[model samples]
Target: MKENVALIGWIATVMTGVVAPALILALIWKTPDTLLRTGEAGQFVSATASVGGFFSSDITTVQSTTGSIAVYNTFSAPRNQLLVVRETLKNGLQLCAENKPDTCVGLAGSWAGDMKPVPHARHRFAGLVTGIGNSGASLWLLIGILVSVGATGILAQHVDREGRRRS
Candidate 1:
């Protein structure tokens, strides 16, 4: 009866320590960091776009009282032409121009109250941003799992030996 109990305990300890650790390591090994980063970036872009879309109709006109000379004017053309230009500018700013360090800093400092400096802030779906965030989280989780598994494996071996001795 004592031997049976010891054997059961030993098996349980192995499962808790050895198998669990192995599973964690396997998961970590399967998920690469770059893949996670890509996913996170995608998610962030998606979420930003989704929320941006909701507020698209609520366009706020910025009246520049400071009299900055404009380099380009869409107002000189028809409404459709102006719309196309605006769309193009928005896309360009969101994807390419926004990431430039000088532009980012300048815009962030220049923008008025409650305005976030998103160089690439354009309306789109939330999938990209959510995916990116999830991927990053997954990578962190994998790292945590790896560390936990390593510690638990050591503990399990110790417990297994102790159980064997008792048996």
Candidate 2:
């Protein structure tokens, strides 16, 4: 009787967990792209994001480096605004040559809002992940949860209590 009751409880728990996520996914799948129309609301959101991104993060308004240029704001945060205008190359300032236009060197490229400073961050490794993460914070939260779960799993493997001992 006890085993049967426990089995039923386990099944219910599994069903609730699986069904809730499935239903949510189905709803999202059925949702139309036009659900959130682009107009005043979109513009307002973009404006808010630009202002908020600038204040919340260590984003410089304008940055010019040897290989690229960067501007941090909601609209441009995901990618560096690299524009090339006609100019005479008589001389380049040490600051410009060194790419130290204040927070400019750190940005490597578009994936980095400039160019990648990290080791071996080749083009193959899709920038969409980092780009989205850089622009929106929701990705960070999802990554954090994944990392926490993995860490907890590792701890569970190694940090077990002592086995029961009998005299």
Candidate 3:
């Protein structure tokens, strides 16, 4: 009976895990391209941009190293945004310089928003974009909640004891 109960709980968790995100995406996104939209409209779209210098004071935003230029919001958390942008730049280097030499430098490009940041951090960051729209800025918040809930439930099932152990 206890095993049955555990099984049911696991199934419930799994169902909720899947259904909740689906429902949220359906209601929030409301379109097929929603996930791919950029800058407040949808998930961060991938683009190529020039490499600006890094900052020790505020790593969340990458400023243009040279002349007054656009700053990328990064849309990353305070903790890992630097690294995420670094990797993205690494990939972009390969894609733009190696893959397509013609578009290596100059000109405006799009950037994919990364949401992997420290959950406890209490900062909301923005980046430079081609243009701004009125899309909700809380999409990252929603994705974070879904991931946290799903992970917590899974951890509970694994760590939970079915009954008291016999001596």
User: Tens digits of per-residue lDDT for model 1 on 70-160?
Assistant: 2111112211211110112111211112232221101111222222333554424232323323434456556555655665576667668
Best by TM-score: 2
> What lDDT tens digits, residue by residue, belong to model 3 across residues 1-167?
65666567666664555554455444434322111111111222233234446652211222321122223332221221111121121112111222233322221334444334333433121221211111222454455457667766765665475343421
Clashing pairs in 2: 108-114, 108-115, 108-116, 109-114, 109-115
User: Candidate 2 lDDT, tens digit per residue, 1-167?
Assistant: 54455446545544444443444444433433221111110111111222434335443333333233332332222233232221111111111112222322222123222222334323321222233222233444445455555555644443342112211
Order the candidates by lDDT, highest first — what do you get?
3, 1, 2
**TM-score: the better of candidates 2 and 3:** 2
Q: Which model is ahead, 1 or 3, in terms of lDDT?
A: 3
Stretches of model 1 off by over 4 angstroms after superposition = 1-132
lDDT of 1: 0.32
Number of the predicted model whose lDDT against the real structure is largest = 3
lDDT of 1 at 72: 19
lDDT of 3 at 14: 47
- TM-score ranking from best candidate downward: 2, 1, 3
Better of 2 and 3 by lDDT: 3
Clashing pairs in 3: 47-110, 71-128, 72-127, 72-128, 73-126, 73-127, 73-128
RMSD to true structure for each model, in Å: 15.5, 16.6, 15.5
